[model samples]
Target: MIRPVAVIGAGPFGLSTAAHIKASGIPVRVFGDPMVSWRDHMPAGMLLKSTPAASSIDAPRRGHTLADYCAAAGISRLAGVEDIVPVGTFISYGEWFQRELVPGLERVRVVSVDHRSAGGFEVELESGESFTARAVVVATGLSGLSHLPPELAAAAADGPAPTGPVSHSCQHHDLSRFAGQELIVVGAGQSALETAALAAEAGARVRVVARRRVGFGAPPWRQPRLRPGSPFGRAWSLWALSHYPQPYRYLPARTRHYLVRRVLGPLGAWWLRDRFEGKVRVEEIDRVVGAEALDGAPVLTVRTRAGATGRLVADHVIAATGYRVDIAAMGFLSHGLRTRLAVSRGTPNLGPGYVSSVPGLYFTGLPAAASYGPVMRFVCGTEFASPRLTRHLVAAHG
Candidate 1:
């Protein structure tokens, strides 16, 4: 019997996973479009928060990398977002990767998914067509889930009324779209900072809401010992290394999870803090209490940690709030698959191999990131994830 597998999503993770599986010569069907979400969402003039080394999809077999592309074009590689890597450019790279590496990918969306009574899976698409396979892998990026603070919903509903011109910064594209508009940005992460910077350059009067009394770092970092080449190379890469094999499991579960939070969340904030100064106002330890439309502007009642409260008026409001991965949000999930997916804190319970407790079902990307650490979400993890997932799936079917 010919073994078949279905791979969902087409971002870096989905694309890379498909490339690897295809190379293994397994019959694989991939769903979704090139940069479907990334190209359509994300504002214009946005720079990548990650460096070239960390933000690339690993090509299979012969190995053409982002570095190869840059070198071929004589484009110098840098460690930081010194310049914006346009979504269009990345989309182009992804297309080239697909055509040059894994051709014949299915470009339809998985409108719904169903598990066969005899085992395995089937995906029903919007076109009323369904494909069945022995296993399915979900690699959709943050496409299915994003959190818009409940506080902004009412104002957002009011005639698309912006705080001053408020919108979730993710939807922001061309700077020319908001020339001379007053914008209030929320959050201190890369997306928030980049949105504010781009809006400012677009000539918008912008101020960022840094609610933390003291904002966090711009990117997570670590002590010198954790570098990949260091003696305690694992420890040296601490800031960037979200996990460390057997050492992590030996520790108490709470302690292990604590270490993960410290390294991935706060460390990232620390690495990027210095960049926010002057470019945007930082309101540390502040909270958005309530927002109401006053004189056609968003009047946000904010309370600082010091117990002082005030109002901020802006034409628009941007919530750089991060994304979520609850499987329920994925419209494509079938009741059978949903029931089978292991649940831990509303996410799939993933084993060490990145397989869910559901036997043949596998997971990659954010779903596995919690257990696999930050690497699952980064492009760098393809080396570990792709091979592991592909090998396991192939062996089981073979």
Candidate 2:
């Protein structure tokens, strides 16, 4: 019997996994616009938080890497500790990787994935084509998962129309459009701080209203170390988490959950420190009591850490809040399949080999972070996820 697999994302994990599957002698079809999120969602001129070495897609075979693309394209091989990566450079590298390694990747969107009655998965595409495969891997990156606070969501709904003053951080590709206007950015993470700085540089007067005092990450290590590299900062704990992903599952569930959340909590990148400080005003508001639209402007009522209440008015509100992965938000999964898949804290619960409760069904990337650990949340995660998943699949069916 010929067993084939369908990979439903063309991002780093999807492309990496598909490349590994093909290398393992298994037939696979990978679908989606390559690097769509990086190309369309992120603002131009944005820089990656990860270093050059960690910001690569893992190819099963040698010769394909971000460094290779940079060398071939005559761009600076951004491998130095002080070197910062631009979003466009990363996207171009991914496109190059797909072309060279994961050729035949379909640039079509996956409409739905349902279980075939006999066995395997029935996949539908936006072009109205369909096919059946023995397995399907959900590698869709942060799509349909941008989170907004409840108060902000309600205020956005109360407007005369959708897409009002309130917008999630992922929705904007160009921050320069808000020029000469007052903008309020919420949250203190990299996205929030970077967006605030970008908006300011774009000529928008921006203030970041975060619940907690802002924090910046330590500068990247200037020299190589004995331990392996990780996208997360250089810490013994992070090094352990990066290297021992499979073993991380054995720890208590609460411990796993806490590490995932706290290890990389709201902190700005080191490079962003100069641009964000003194450039953007950061208010450490204790809580957002209410958000309302008054005469088309946004008003945020908040209490300070000192327990004083005040209001901030801005022409628009940008919630730089990060994404939250909930399997139910993935509309492509059929009701029957989604209902059957087990979940932990809104993420798909995966067993060994990253397989969900439904046989041959898999979840990687952010959705798998809960089960796999913090490494799954970054592009470097493909280094671990791709080979492991491919090995399991090839052994089972090849």
Best by TM-score: 2
Clashing pairs in 2: none
How many backbone collisions does model 1 have? 35
Off by over 4 Å in 1: 1-3, 77-88, 157-166, 213-262, 266-276
Q: Could you tell me how far off, in angstroms, the CA of residue 110 lies in candidate 2 after the best superposition? A: 1.5
The Cα local distance difference test for each model comes to 0.67, 0.86
Which consecutive 10 residues in model 1 have the weakest lDDT in total?
225-234
Compared with the true structure, what per-residue lDDT tens digits does model 2 show for residues 1-398?
Answer: 56579998888988899889888888899999999998988888899998888888999888788888899999988887678999999999999999988899998888899998898999989999988889999999998888887978766875222258788888888888899999999999999999999999999999999888898987866524765655676667788778778987777778878878877788899999999889898788888998888887789899999999999999899988888888889999999999999887788878888888898998889888888899898998999898998887776656
